[model samples]
Target: MSLMDYTDQWLSVVQPQISQGSSWLADLRQGAVEQFATQGLPHARLENWKYTDVKALAKREFVLPKNAATQADALVAETSLALDGIRLVFVNGLFSAAHSQLDALPKGANVLPLADNANVAKTLLGQVAAANFSGFTALNLAAWQDGVVIDLAANTVVEMPIYLQFVSTEHTDACLIQPRILIKAGVYAQATVVEHFAGAEEAANFTNVVTEVDLADGAQITHYKLQQESVHQYHIASLHVQQQRDSRFTSHNICLGGKLARQDIQVELNAEGAEVNLNGLYLGNGRQHLDNHTLVNHNAPHTNSNEDYKGILNDRSRGVFNGRVVVHKNAQKIEAHQSNGNLLLSDKAEIDTKPELEIYADDVKCSHGSTTGQLDENALFALRSRGLDEAMARGLLTLAFANEVIDRIEIPAVHDRIELAVAGRLPEKFNLKGLV
Candidate 1:
């Protein structure tokens, strides 16, 4: 059957859950599905998807996760790593109210499921996301199960952080899941949020995610994403952040999972004096692959943006990084910098780094740099001479190479968690011993 036939069947499976469906949303989904039908998954011929193959995803037969016959208490009890704030939980791409905890929300903080909040989800759904996202994204918009909506009131500062944990289970075999999240920060508001994606085991699964963030004037937001899934799974995520005047937005993406994964992130500075920082790290081993494509747009004058992404490739794995910074003609005095650096451990492993800068404004300052190579032999030699084993020496150097980007993360707890996760991925490379 064609891809649209599968989407239609998928919609029929979830038809019972459509509660008070907005007419506009229904029509939007219908159109998006039709668009998806006309054009199947983008092939290598497509400019944007020239590297990754979407046909591999189109060949799979995926089913929606049935309702949990298992007790939810088992799921809630497993979330033992307690953080100091509200928590939203989703299982198999379905939001679980019974599993969420919101006891410490401040006076003006509002948290609700996006699917239930139809009007709000519709207002924000396709508004800021990439218009021509991949086929998986189109499928997500056409038949998304549930999402999260977070709204912070003006002049309010949420003392505690908000944690979002998405768990993928129930599909013992191959399946597809999509989770969507929309966040709005009112004027003069401040908040921090953490999003984590994890899988149950090494199963053939796919996660297609889209997140939209809107920040008003003078607002500040710090957002981080942690990805760790089974090696047999695949993950694709897109994050679109829009900032108003005098707003500060800091975002970090940590990728440490999936057999074949790709992330597309974009940040737009819409008003004057807005500042943004984007940082990312991806660790790959075995035969896995990780790709990150990011774009930063300076639309107004006096806006600043800085970005740095690092990757460590080992074994036979491969990694790709593409970062772009654009300065509009009207955006005078805009300053932007972007850099991508990668370290390859094995001769068989490969990495491609491309940092691009496009400027239309005469008064803007922008630069981009990219580098791909192996670990420094001089540093490894120094460490090995100090009574360290070959594997230990390589691990130390790899850790230090990745630590430069990790140190940029301002949050202590989040930084620590990411560092520990990266450390777990490295092992001693015997081949580099004498060369180092």
Candidate 2:
């Protein structure tokens, strides 16, 4: 069936649910639906989505999950990250109060579920709008059910990180879920947020997530996203951020599992002295496909941005990295650097990496580099010549290559978790307990 036909059928089933919001939100949903209808699912023809073809997503007949509350308990137990923090759990894209813990937040910190606070939700929803909304983003805005809104008061610092956990529990049939998140950090405030996605190993699910972050002057935020869904699942997520004067934003993205996964990150430095740092790691095994696309816009003078992304591909898996940095005509004195590195564990594995720099200002310092190659034979042989076996030596070298990005993570718990996750995907004979 054509995408238009499938969208028409799906909208018919979800129109009623979309009509429950206030007039402004209703209008927003309507406009988003129209936009999606006009553009349809993104394909290779689109420059941004050239590497990841989402047309395959339209082939499946996915339905809304039924009574996600019933599976919330087991799913939560199975997908715990064991990180200490305030937890906000979502079951199939809907906020679950029973599974969340928000009582211990600081006095100035506010964590509210959008479903319960529609009036306040409308004010913050889609505030940091996407510069060029993709078809999937439009569809998410139209069909989103529930999400979390995090607000920090001026000058207030949140000591503990905030964890947003999204769990899908539809294993019997194909399911579609849209999860939305909005974060506003007040001036001089500092906080950390972790967005995690996980689901049953055998479930055939499609998860589309959109996250918007707004940082006030002098505010600082450290954000981490970990995607570990079922190998049979399809995942597409977009993160858009706006930074004000002297504000700082840092992101660490880890993509580990999914049949086809794509992540898009866009940051706009709208005021002078704003800074951004982005680090990402992705691991692909079997025939899985993983793509990471990032854009940093230097709109103001004296802004700084850094990006580094690494990928490890095994078997026939494919990986892609596209990093674009743009410095406006008037945005002089800007410093931008981007790098993408890939390791191919199998001869059949493939990688496509592009690092772009568009600097209109004369006083800007910008550079980008990308490298794709197999494991270094000399290094492997050196390790094997010592006490290590071939498989152990290869695994150690791969982990060392990935540790460059992992070691930059500020949170110890998160860093340890990622190390274990990466170790699990390595060769069986490799022991990563003491290495990482």
Error of 1 at 70 (Å): 3.9
What are the Cα lDDT values of the candidates? 0.78, 0.85
TM-score of 2: 0.95
Model 2 CA deviation exceeding 4 Å by range: 1-5, 376-378, 429-436
Per-residue lDDT of model 1, residues 1-436, tens digit only: 4444455554554344432268998887766666556655666676666667655565666766655524445644553235656888877677777777888888888877777786866667777775456665666677677778888889878877788887776365565677778888899899888888875654467788888898999999888888877777888888889999999998888898998888988889999999999889999999888989898899999999999899999898889888888899889999998888888888888887778888999998887888886678988889889988877777777888888888887667767767776787775453333332
Give candidate 1 misplaced runs (Cα > 4 Å). 1-20, 69-81, 428-436
lDDT of 2: 0.85
lDDT of 2 by residue, 393-426 (tens): 8889899888899899888888888888888886
